[model samples]
Target: MKAIIAKSNIGGVITTPPSKSYTIRALLAAALASGQSRIFNPLVADDTEAAAEVLTQLGAGIKRQTDCWEVTGGNLAPPSSPHQKLNCRQSAATLRFLAPICAALQGTSCITFAPGLARRPMTPLFDIFQQLGVRSELTENSLNIHGTGGQFKSNEVSLPGNISSQFISGILMATPLASEGLTIHLTTPAESKNYLRMTIDCLQRFGINVEYDDNLEEFRVEHQAYQPTDYIVEGDWSSASYFLGMGALSGPVTVTGLNADSFQADRFMLNCLRRMGAEVIINGDSVTVNSSPLRKTDTGLNEAIDLLPSVACLAGVSAGESVITGLDRARLKESDRVTAVADNLKQMGIKVIEESDRLTITGGTPRGAVIDSFDDHRIAMAFAMLAAICGDTVIEGAECVNKTYPDFWEDFQKVGGKVSINE
Candidate 1:
């Protein structure tokens, strides 16, 4: 879909979508528990739906309610039909978590992927599964795992952490069911450490305990049961970052339903906006970023890599040249966001230099130009915010926001941003 943006200045109060990370984590935890688990404020977006659907296919019962989800889980049965295929649509988390989970279920299962996900990285997790005695028939498009139910050859495994924390999260979720439990040692320093912490936090909410060191290099889990309980997903800092950026570029935009104390990594977005001289007001559970004289500074996105696209938009309109780093891992996301962000910004008459691990965007008012989202949700939303500040612009693949924020277009309009859909 295409989004036509004409009005530059935008402001108003709007609540951001629920956190996709927390929502999926809650769903996976509910699926691992033995009884009914209620999940509140869950984000019912495409990525999360993939997790729910796949978990349901693996024998969990998921009942959707208007306000919450009731899921009965912990009894994973083989599919009634032959060669049950779990289509993990573009959610990397769903694919990673469920693949190891199916292996632990002690049955033969095939996990398939969408076209974009088909090319995602699977190594190390694949090898880790094999080290645990999981036989697999892996191809470019699908993975068929065969393992002895409730059995793992060893109680300890090691894998590099620089690639993704999801691999460790996947194995950790399944270890509770391991006959002897399991210990995981990180072969290298962990990247996206916050995500690992989120996984552990989610596990604790389900009454599962995990032992880990301060550096997060090692974790130990013993045989335990996951206790089902009500879980509430918090608002997403990642999604709110864009609106906050919009407010920083425009003025006085208040985004509600956020926990200021949450450990979500994208909370760094608030700090970054302030560093750029944006006036920020924080109420109990809401944050407002008001427009002010902006200044460019060195921005490190190591901990908040997902904030790259939105932050880069800020860099484009700030006073001086901004050097943004720690985005090398972002290449493996929904799209090649590094190139995509730089390319999209260039279309708007902004000077941007893209590199393997960094981006340098020269600050100036960008002129309106048609931009492409490359079918990435974050890319679409980030550029859409940029379009609001740059004046009349067209964003192709704007519907990609449905991946995480289904009502983004409507919300954009509600916030006083002009948007027209070109059908």
Candidate 2:
């Protein structure tokens, strides 16, 4: 899939898509509830679909509706026939969240991962699972676990802060079913604390109380039932950041349907945009950005790491040099995003310096160059936004957006972006 994006300015209003992070959290949280639950404005993307399918196979009743999804879930019933295989479809969240839940169920289960996802690290969370008496065997691209089909062995689980927050969330969601409670101690000061905040939000929304200190060094949760409730998914700040980046260089772009108080970590992009001199307007649930004197950035990405590609793209067109830090976690994503962003920027004749944990981009007028997305959705979207100012831009693997936003191209076009597909 190739996308040819020509230089143009986008204007008018486009509503941001619902958050994939929140939708998946809602699905997983709902699956543990004892009764019917309604989730409104859920994101129906590849990743969220993977979560839904896995939950369905776990014997949860999931029904799609016009405006929401009705989920009836309680105890998971092992697929009537034994030895059922589930494909996680390259979603890290799906794999991480499901692994621990399957262990809590104490049932025979096997999960297969897409080829590209096989190499993602898992031992950190698995170590804790093993501590809870969940036995697992790892082979290439798949995980086979024998779950006790009930509460885990109550114990203190310590995890490093650098890994994906999904690790913390996955365990937090599953430990409540254990015979006793569990305490999560952060061995290092927790990084990406906002993602954990989202996890805590989900847990509390489902009627599970979480105890944590101000520093977020420790968390304690006991065996508790997840109560079903009506929930609404919020607009994704990560996805919306792309358009806001475009708005900084282009004109009159406004994204609606976002929550100002969202726990979604990417919401911090608004502050960064302000720092870079983009005119941002927050009216009700929508945010509008207009042309401004965009400048270079110096910010930490510990929490908003997913915004790296977009923010880096914004930096590519700014007037001076920009430095972004805290990218060590980026290497573990679907693709080595840090390297991918740096390489693609270099391809476009932009001056960039790539390091293991930081990126320094000297913003100037960039020329369009053929770029590969490295099968990363954010990379494709990031460069797409950058294309508006470049001489010409062609993005391969453009369809990767389906992982989070299936209609990304259409939405881009809707906002007056001059984009065409070359298939």
- Candidate 1 residue runs with Cα over 4 Å from true position: none
Write down the lDDT that model 2 would get: 0.88
Q: lDDT by residue for model 1 over 1-423, one digit each (tens)?
A: 799999656989999999999998899889889999999999999999999988888889999999999999888865766567888888998989888888888678888888898767888777888679888888878888885686988888889878778888898888888889999999899888898999999999999999999999999999899999999999999999989998988867999999999889899998999899999999999999888878996998877899999989889998999999999878989899999999988988889998899999999888888888889999989888878876779988888898999989998988888899987
What lDDT tens digits, residue by residue, belong to model 2 across residues 53-107? 9899988889999999999989885565666777789899999988887878857
What TM-score would every model get versus the actual structure?
0.98, 0.98
- The per-prediction tally of clashing pairs is 1, 6
**C-alpha lDDT of residue 91 in model 1:** 90
Model 2, position 46, has a per-residue lDDT of 95
CA lDDT, every model vs. true structure: 0.88, 0.88
